[model samples]
Target: MGYQELLQNKQYLFWTLQFVGWSGWAMSFYLGIVMWGRPPDNYGFYLPTIAMIGMTITLGLRWMYHLTWDNGLLTRVVAILGGSYGAAVLWMFSRGVIFYNAFPEERKVYEGGSMSFFSYFDGSVSAFWVMLSWSALYFGIKYYLLMQEERQRSLKAMNMAHEAQLKMLRYQLNPHFLFNTLNAISTLVLDGNNSLANVMVTRLSRFLRYSLDNDPMLRVTVAEEIEALQLYLDIEKVRFDERLRLHFDVDSAASEALMPSLLLQPLVENSIKYAIANAIDGGSIAISASVTGRDLELVVADDGPGLDLRNGRLPKGGGVGLANTRERLKALYGNKQSFRLSTTEPHGLTITIRIPLENTTDSE
Candidate 1:
């Protein structure tokens, strides 16, 4: 069992350890007396009485140490040393009193009192070492538990911050797309194209509702995400008409695989903004998904002028959509996912993403 699990039932843990530790010490003490070949006539009763006294004294020491737990280091150190020495003296005196009464023949040497000063001093020295060892173990366990609690708290705080960052990045969809869609609808209405404007408005409503209904923290099926993307593309198709061409190449095996909701929207939007809208004849965008080994691979490519590379890197005006997408992937998958940009064949841009394949059954 884990230390935390054992510590949860502290009363049981303490009593169990206390019984085991003292019993083992008593057994060893008895064995040593036997090995010496001359145990006391009433060694059974005498030894048990001495062990009981030691256990009682150590219990009191435990209580005192607990009271000084939050004190300064010097104060705690002093308490341990002083408390252990005092307990040892009390234990040794109790042992002497029991031994004196049990052996009347040996009492002639100290007929005036129960025990002599020199006897007390010698016994207390040995008892002091045992008491000190117990005290050290108690404090060592206390400090270990304290450190564990602090580490758990630190990890919890980091996870909360990580979640907040991910939510911010997920919700940062392109505002320019919203404004442009509204402008297109306005233009369509003014030109006596009320039917097409109404269609665009319906598609825009569905897309916004989809974005609002799903939580950023949750993943969606590949099929469900594609359905939401279709709503978004419907609005764009109205504005571009024949200028926008779209294709899908999703494997049936990958359709039920799960991915972060709205993950592909930003990539596709970046393609339309940078490649299609800027080109005279517009462009064709192809989105494909397939399962490769243990990963789900997704690709978004467009047939239009690709980004001008400086030192093999995107220029400064690389769209916020790409950056936002990159940040979201890092937050969700850490280093387990990959996002890459490359030049498509015959002059275009291609963005590829690979993430661990998780299916609906895997989630359950």
Candidate 2:
């Protein structure tokens, strides 16, 4: 692998640090001896030999420490200290043998004085310090990298959750409307009204085409949304006949304002359910839109029984459409958008939505 790849790999990094640390330490030791007028007889070979020995022992301690590093702070500390001391003793014995063979005359102190373990350990004090430092740095870096990885994973999971919610809201429209329209067409065919049944089928196909063409996460112009809603109302008109009427008063200037695709379908469908279908004489549903300063406001109101407003707001058991629309609006716009439901003047329900006027594109 390349040098950059080697530096990134944990196993390679450990060996690199061992080689760099010991080689630098040996170079400094040799320079110190030279400056003090006590230069080694053959430091070119001797210093390199010492560095290789230190690197080998350092690598062994690294593996030993890895086996018990996560046992706990107390356990790791004890293992590091004890393991470092043991490796230092072994290194000292190897160095002693090399030194005596290279210069037998320099072994006067060992021959003349009493041999003891303390003397060997005293000579290897520097090795213990090197091993301890290596252990501290290893654990510190590993923990920091682990924390970074966890934070990235959390952000990825949150993004996935947001996308899933949008998809659920988009697909919710398909089955509910499909079932109702198919049932209406079935009734028309059974009554020998084949021409009207064919008209309903055609309108239903056009409505589903518009709804399914775009991605759930995409935003479309207000004019585009209105067109899709018109197609839906046409299909319902077949079922309700002269009993259902729709009025559109969209401001030309605000028609191009962007909104989530199919955002208004459920609200209009809710009006049909609780207003037109529930009334004996049927009812009229009106959609109006206008832009005022920094905000775009749209309203869907119908003349029917209106809400009960028992405790406050509409009665419970409201269909999934209204609830799903509310959740999607909250997820997309947070607190920047508003959805308000209230009873109309005489007897009816009105849903008002206000969103920021962020789209600058004119209707095409």
Q: Which candidate is the best by lDDT?
A: 1
lDDT of each: 0.86, 0.80
Candidate 2 local lDDT, 1-364, one digit each (tens): 8965764586776667667777788888888988899765765777788678867886787778778866987888888788888777777777766776665555565666785334655777876676667666666767765676687689889878988889898787789888989999999999999999999999999888877787777788789889988899999999998889889999987898888888888888888988999788999999988898888898889988887765434456776887788788888899998878888778888888888885845433
The numbered model that scores best in TM-score is: 1
- The lowest-lDDT stretch of 10 consecutive residues in candidate 2 is 308-317
Query: Model 1 off-target regions past 4 Å?
Result: 1-4, 7-63, 93-121, 174-177, 189-198, 310-313
lDDT measured at residue 299 in model 1 versus the true structure, 0 to 100: 93
What are the runs in model 2 whose C-alpha is more than 4 Å off?
Answer: 1-137, 251-254, 291-296, 310-312, 356-364
Candidates in order, TM-scores: namely 0.80, 0.64
Residue 231 of model 2 has an lDDT of 93
